[model samples]
Every structure is written in structure tokens, then in C-alpha cells.
Target: MIDGWYWKFIGVGLIIYSMIVGMLVPLKPSIELVAPSAAKTGQQINLEVTGYNTNYSGSASIRAWLKDEEGNAVLSKNVTVINAQNLVANFDIPGFLPSSDRVVPFTLILDHPVDGAMVSPDAVFITQDSISKVEGQTLWQKDIINDLTLNTAFTFPSMSLIRETIRNTFYHVPLWFAMVIIFGAAVYWSIKYLRNPQSYQYDNRAVGFTSVGILFGILGTVTGALWARFVWGSYWSWDIKQIVTAVALLIYMAYFILRNAIEDDDRKGRVAAVYNIFAFVALIPLIFVVPRMMDSLHPGNGGNPGLGANDLDNSMRMIFYPAIIGWIIIGLWLANVRYRLLDIKYNLMNK
Candidate 1:
């Protein structure tokens, strides 16, 4: 009787694990549309929906839908692809009521029967006029480059892979935020280190977190590069975003070189602290300031428009924001583990 009960408990646990994992993992759908967000009013848009049968050896069909703002159906159709992992369904926007109107918004939906999943519609706005509406208000004076919004959306199966990619959030942008935190901590330690070189613990703590921060910096850069490669064509292009990230990473790399060049540990910490303060300052121009001042292939540019209806839809955000938090926590957790391990290694050596 006890053996049977034990097996039952194990079965229950497996069921729960399967549910959680299912939600986390995302299957990659085929590239349906080349440029779904940049359509102009009255223009024909073709959407191709395709995916693989991850579980079975059979074929799959994808249903497509085009909906208006009021959730009224503009178009709906199903396409079946046989023995093929990917399929493309092409359709055209029938044009809005009046051609005189500048911008039109529509949604694209893809349904996968095998997975019993319906990917919510990806929204897009089309315009030929000079002005655009954000939040239903017209902003006429905004520059065309800055005012444009190109929104796109996709769903993938790897949940943990997706979550780790999300660390690109705090790891990418907020590390600068946390680099500010680490540098600020280093400066505090530097001041203390200068006052009393005898207490080396603060100096070590500063070095530990700074090293971890650099690791995070490298991670953010690599992930950004991968993302850019898929979207922007190349892994390492000389675009404004690429240049800024390179400069920021280079600046931190120089900090390590500067530390190694010095003979005395005390002098190294003090000098490095002074230089670390400059890291954030240099980063500001490269990551934030210059990207805005100059034109960039990246989003959120000064002349380029910010995120909008087309860029991020509700379905993407449902996974995206959680990914950001999960990644940030995971990064911090890794950093903390490294910091503690370093502290232990330092103590044993001194002993």
C-alpha cells in the first residue's frame, strides 16, 4: 500500500512540473511577415504563418486573423501545410474606409491547432501623412524620424531561454544603473581605503563587485549583439548602438588594465576607484547621450520614434516583463554567489 502511495505522489509531482515547464517554454513560429509594422494605408500586406511539430511527426495548420481596433474581424482564414514544418499565408489589407486618412491600425493573429494555442494578434499602424497619433492624441510638431513607430511581434517555445534573454533588461540597461551602484560603492570604499590602507576588506569588496559588474556588462553586450544580428543583419555592425556598447565595454576593460599596471594594491584600489567614477560618466555619453544625439538603427533614438503600438503588443509583454525580472534576479543571484566565493577565497589565502 505504501509503495503504491509513493508512486502516486511522484505522479502528481510530475504533472505539476509539466504544467510549469509548459508555460515557460515557447515554440518558435516561422517568419510570417517580413515587415508587418510598416504598412501604409491601402497597402497590401502578406503574412506567412509556419511552425514545426515538436512532439509528433505529423503536419500542422495555422489560422490567421486580421482584426480592427474595436475587435471587429477584418479578415480570417486558415492555411494547411502538408509534411512541411513551416508555412506562409499571404494576405492584403483591404484599405481603410477613406484613403484620405493618414494612419490605420490592425492586428494579426495566428492559431496553432497542434499546440492548442492562439498567438494573440500582432498590432501595426500604417501611415503616409506627416503626423501620427500616440494614445489617441495627435502630435503634429514631432519630427518624422522621431515620430515613426514600427511594431512587430513573435512567440517562442523556450521559456527559460526566453527568460535568460530577458536579463538583457537589467543586465543590459540596468547594469549601467547598477554600474552606477557598484562604482558609487567603489568610491565609498576608495575614500575609506585612502583614509586607512590597513583595512583592506573594503578595497576587496569593491574589487569583487566591480569584477562581477564587468561580467554582467559583457553578458549584456553579447546578448544585445545576438539580438541585433537577428534583427539588424550583422552581429557586429558599426551602428550607433554597437559603437556605444563597444566604447562602454572598452572603458571597463581599460579599468582592469590600469589596475594591473600598478605595483601597490593600495595605490591600485585608490586610483581605480577614481577612474571607476569616470566609467559612468563615459558610459552616459556612449550608451544614452550620443545614441540620442546621432541617428541610430536602434529603437528609442532622438530622431527615431519610441516604443509604441506596433513595437510591443500585449502578448509579448506578458512574457517580456516577467523575463526581465527573472533575469535580473538570476544575474544578481549569480553575482552574489561569485562575491561570496571570492570573499572566502580571499580569507583562506590571507589565513
Candidate 2:
């Protein structure tokens, strides 16, 4: 078995590491087009660009272009840098250019003196004009690559709706992960207690793990509420996941209440162990099944994809996985301390 002090040291080190990496990283420079989504043909449209980390001073060289569905660049325009975070591009839509209601994608290329070259893709320049076949040379080749220099401190992706609050992804999500791990351990001890009713240590350990797991769950819920207040416009949005999680916590809380209501030591241990088993079994469906059955604001539920695909990139995975592991180690340490304290109090009371 690993020494207790070793676990403590590892837990503290990982916690500190996660905090440092999550906060200090600078996001890659990106741009968001702020002009109208649709434009008319044969018109000179002024497009506004809002940038993040795209050091758009007067000295910075910038280029913007619109690519149609067939990978053809119909319009190449010069970018006017307004400030470090803003720019404007003028596009003269050719009358001969074929038009459709479908959105046209664009790209913005910036050469920053300090940050190096950066490219923001999937920008929009839609048109609602008549479609016509116009033969034109593709001004920009698809083979050109713009590689960004990796920052010393890895950065998180800027996403719509989440914005800077994306940083919360590191701290908030891991709490539930840690809670689940601690609770799984509690279930194991509860099963052991049931197998050997004579060993009070198993019962004590079950209680200790359950207490700490519930504490982590409570912290997770509060942090989630705070995250929702910014993203969902309310602290408690009555989301399916939120409601079910609240119900699950209440069920676990009853386990403690049930233990206290029983007076006889042996009887209390036996009953609480059984109840803990039942609560753990119910918790799986409450947290996983019930939430997925309905629409929820939370990810990984109601046909909404979670962390897979583009949501979690490699840079975030580095710190995120470590954060979960670190929190789990700390949670187990807390449970062990609680168990030893309870054991000491029981021995002293008997004397």
C-alpha cells in the first residue's frame, strides 16, 4: 500500500499544477465577423471583425477572403485593423458570382509581430442573390498552411456562449468526477460490511467514504449552479440533469439520517450498509439514465455531445485528466482521515 503522506504530497502537487496551467495559458488568436450574415450581389459591403489575441495594430499585416462551396475564392479583400481586437474588411461582391441562400464561408489571416501567423476559419459572408455560373481563377490555393506557434502555457479554445467562463471547465467538471470515484469506493466498503457484520472497521470506512463523497457532490452542485448562472441565465434552471442530481443527493443524504435514527451499534451498521448499497444502485440511474431521457442544458445528455469531438482538445486533456485524478486522491485522503478520527473517538468513549 502507498504511504498516506505520499498520497497527500501527490494530491497537493497535482492541484497546484492544474491551477497554474489552467489560468496562465493564452488562447490562440481568433476572429468573429460582426457584420450581417447575408449580403446582396454587386454591392460593396463593410464587414466588422472582432478578434481575440489577434494583435491588430496598424503595423500588423492582415488578409481576408470568401470561399464558396466549390472551394473557390470569389472575393479577396484587404483588412483594416481598427485596434488590437477589432478590424474591418471591405468586400465588393461581383455581379457575375453565383449566389444562393446557403452561407458562404470565409477566412481571416493575420501576421502579428509578437504572436506570429494565425488563421481564423469558418467566417461567414452569405448571399441571397440569383445563382449563375461564373468562371474565375481561385485566388487562394487550399494548399497554403498557416501554422501557429504553440504557447509555453497551453491555451483553451474560445467557444461561443461559454467565452472566458470556459476556464470553469477545469475546476467544475472535475468535482463530480472526484465525487463519483469516492462514492464508488464507499459502495465497495458497504458491500464488504454486508459480507462481514462482525468487523466494525468496514462499517466505519463505509460511513467515512460516504461523508466525503457527499461533501464533494455538494461542492460540485454549487459550482455547477454558479456556472449555469452565467451560461444559462439562472442559478437553478430546472434542467433535467440538475433536478435529477438534486434528487440523487437527497437520496444519499437519507442514508446518513437513517444511520443516526438507529440506536443499537450493530443494528445501525447492518441497516446503514444495506441502505448504502441501495442508494448507490439508485444513484447510477438517477445521474445517468434519468438525465439522458429528457432534454437538458448539461452536456452528454439529450442527444447533446459531451467532451468528444472538438469540445475537448489535447491541450485541455493534459490538465483536465490530471485534475480529476488529483481530486480523487485528495478525496480518498479525506475519507481515511475521517475514518481514523471516528475510530479514535469510539475507542476513547468505550474506556
Where's the lowest-lDDT run of ten residues in candidate 2?
Answer: 134-143
Q: Model 1, range 1-351, lDDT digits (tens) per residue?
A: 022244444434443443354355444443333235656644566554434322212435445555555453444333545334444445554434222457656565554544433333455665654432342222111221122112232343322223334323323444444554555555566567667777666666556656766776777667778866766678888887678778887887888899899988668878877787677568766765677677777755354422334444455455444444443443444445555676687678779
Cα deviation of 152 in candidate 1 (Å)?
Answer: 19
Against the true structure, what is each candidate's TM-score?
0.53, 0.87
| lDDT tens readout by residue for model 2, 1-351 | 235488788987888888998888877666644565557566777778787766777454565556555555543466687887887778776654443334455554545545555555656555535555532232234434344344343567866667677777788888888888888899898899899988777888999999998998899899999999988999998988788789889999999999989999999999999998898899988886776667777865345423436667888888888889889888989999998888888788779
lDDT of 2 at 322: 88
- lDDT, model 1, position 5: 41
**True lDDT of residue 203, candidate 2:** 88
**In candidate 1, where is summed lDDT lowest over 10 consecutive residues?**
139-148
Report the backbone clash tally of model 1: 14
